[model samples]
Target: MTRNNYAPYITISREEWAKRSDDPMLHLLNDFETLQGLNEPLTMEEITQIYVPLSRLLNLYVSGAQRLHAATNSFLGSQFLKVPFIIGIAGSVAVGKSTTARVLQRLLSAWPNHPKVDLVTTDGFLYPNKVLEQKGIMNRKGFPESYDIRRLIQFLANVKSAKERVSAPVYSHLEYDILPNELKWIESPDIVIVEGVNVLQVRPRQQQKEPTIFVSDFFDFSIFVDAEMEDLQQWYIDRFKSLRQTAFRNPESYFHRYAHLSDKESEVIATNIWNEINRPNLELNILPTRFRASLILEKGGHHFVQSLKLRRI
Candidate 1:
């Protein structure tokens, strides 16, 4: 059965909210510390306070998946039962899904068994800006309809089918578009993290109406990053400001026009874009998929995940 077609099932949990400390999982995360980009890497307090616990929890999920795979293999008596564990990470734009995916990919790969992890982002499937402009969907960039959903689904299907080589388009944030003819290839990986604003979103129509395949259908696990709308808006504006000073200043950047704006002007433009475009897409398409994820990482104003709501077993 396809992942999405399965009935809603919960992972067996050892406790309501399991906490971990000083697990071997931390050793696998050595490279992940560099990715975090925090100054004074490997501070004793940081390890005890954060990575140790998160990695431990992830280790549990990985262990559980291995057991399931073993069981399925025994039942089928097939040697071809192996496949990369597929994960879906979804959230509104600027809600820090990228960071979460990066961290998870690095930490998860630290395990001795699954040393190869790959991350594929849905932004790669977004229609080129020129196409969106021609289609009058420039304002609907993050909406479900703005993506090449069929191709995205096919890509996931290819990966899940264990294709020897799979290629995907690449997106450029500075250009704010999908670069034509640019692609990233995956020969094989132990794990694949597919992250995007709508990674878990189903097509708008019901199955009986059109029977479409969603990109989310291939996930073994899914995560939704959520925060208060107000907090999200603030975060979006903050990120936009940072981008303006960095990416937008690049001569080849599509958003170079914003580089000349005054700070106040930039803030105004950012807020307007968020309200008229991003917020609407999040409300109409993305946020609605929260219930579809295996876990919800709810963040606070500080951009830290304050609570995790895992599906009840």
Candidate 2:
């Protein structure tokens, strides 16, 4: 069967993309042990074949953006503050987006022109557990509504405006809640990467007419990780099991109870969570925004990126 055409996006196989360069930077996979996600085995081959080219492409965009800024400043006869180039990465839960963000952060920072790079997740913008409980949306924690949309928008606005010493609330994965009085300071960075499931979501209707701003509006480029739903479900379950063996085993872990369960019992719980919560969010909220991405990394089984779809200039 022939694959469907993704118009306006040039799709290329992994092998073809690999041939673009043979630079040593492309084969820097020694850090894979730290960058790989739970239950996700990212190989050096994949990095050289897939992510290296992606980093180079982003470098070009960053360079172009810098040149444009310089030209605009010259035309206006004013030296405006340099705004950071922001990249947004969106995907379903357990789709290895965090790993992708981390890898890109490392790669982008290594570039001489943009040595100062930072990464922040929308998880930090999520409503506190107390707030979610008060709103009766605790179970829908990763949904769009579960975030403090106004604060998130403001945070991005500050960053894009070149505001100094901007800080965001910090969230603890182990406690599964926002930490009071804790902040992640974001100084002026050459590049900032924002990763989340809902980064590509459209602005809410109430603000649609009023200077319309979205989290994505601040993004100079965006990426969406893609995979078959069945594959994603399996990956989610696998990650859950791996966490149970590690992080979830901690007594303070929000999911500590699952750590002691038998393999079959844990599998049942993971499956139910995926089917009841994650799958619905992906179908209704996340997957719908995939077409909005500047690039789509289509992964096959075993977390291997098989093809890439890049929007045509």
Per-candidate TM-score against the hidden true structure: 0.86, 0.95
Model 1 — TM-score against the truth? 0.86
lDDT for model 1 comes to 0.78
The candidate that wins on lDDT is 2
lDDT of 1 at 56: 60
Best by TM-score: 2
Candidate 2 accuracy as TM-score: 0.95
lDDT string for model 1 (1-313, tens) is 6576554545423232335465555665555556642211234344444545555666677778878888888888876746777889999988878777877777777766678889999989999988899999898888888898878988988888988789999998877889897999987887899999988877556546766677778998888888999988988888788778888899999899998888899899999999999999889888889989988877777776656666755
- lDDT for each residue of candidate 2 in 1-313, tens digit (9 for 90 to 100): 9998757899999889888744667545576779988898877777778878888889999999999999999999999998999999999999999989988998788776888999999998999999999999998989999998889989999999999879988889999999988999999899999999999999476736566678899999999999999999999988888999999999999999889888898889999999999999999999999999999999998798999999998
Indicate the worst ten consecutive residues by lDDT in candidate 2.
21-30
